[model samples]
Target: MKIAVIDAQGAGLGKTVIKKIRKEIGLNIHITALGTNPTATSNMLKAGANHGLTGENSICNFCNTNSLDSIIGPIGIICSGGIKGEITSSISQSVFNLNCTKYIIPMQKHGIYIPGTINLKIKNIIEEIVSDIKKNIEKLS
Candidate 1:
């Protein structure tokens, strides 16, 4: 499966997610780190992303044409000018309009409250995503 993990700003979160994915999911799945900046992308790349891309255009291009099976990132990736208000409108539109399954970590810092996910920790969120991915992959058999 081709999974994209996107992030902006410090990208510490993206790096964390990639590390967890690498340790838990193994290398069978392909992971690409898509960041709003080169530093963000490089951070995730060091965490074990098979590939990396940066900038708004790169994100849009990938979203428009590719075989991405799933997208994993903060919920801000779906909102226009989200993620510290740095994500461009085009990036937001692309991810928001994606047809693939999305694994979003609801963040309180973003000032958007997603119902049914209140006060959950980041580690817990990643665990849930990993669990769901395993189940979904199994069912696809």
Candidate 2:
């Protein structure tokens, strides 16, 4: 499956999510890292993303047309304004607008709100997503 992970600043749980997905599932999956900046994208790439893209065109390029099976990130992945302005309504709308399936993680316990996060109940949500994907894949095979 192709999974797109959007991290606006790489400060949130994107890295952790990627690590868990790789270690726990141990499956050959395509992970795309979409970062607001190169650093965020690189961090996820290091974590395990097979491909990484960042910056303005990067957002416009993949946010809409990319055929990702799923997108995982914090609620802010859709935030429409701020530094670099990469994360905009179009980007958020594209993701929120994706006809494809998606898995969105909520904020941390403190409700402090990170720029981009895709796991709220991180462990449980990821487990559920992985479980469902595995089941669907097995059925398809």
Who wins the TM-score comparison? 1
Instruction: Using lDDT, give the best candidate's number.
Output: 1
**Predicted candidate 2 versus true structure: per-residue lDDT over 1-141, tens digit per residue:** 788888777535678777877886665778888887888888998898888888767766786777877788766666676334547776777778876777766665323466555444577776777777667657667
Candidate 1 steric clashes: 0
User: Residue-wise lDDT of candidate 1 within 74-105, one digit each (tens)?
Assistant: 98888887888878889988887778888888
Evaluate all candidate structures by whole-model CA lDDT and list the values in order. Answer: 0.88, 0.73
| 97: Cα error in model 2, Å | 2.0
Report residue 91 deviation for candidate 2 (angstroms).
1.2
Q: What's the residue-level lDDT of 33 in candidate 2? A: 83
Predict model 2's lDDT versus the native: 0.73
For model 1, state the Cα shift of residue 18 in Å: 0.9
Among all windows of 10 consecutive residues in model 1, the one with the lowest summed lDDT is: 132-141
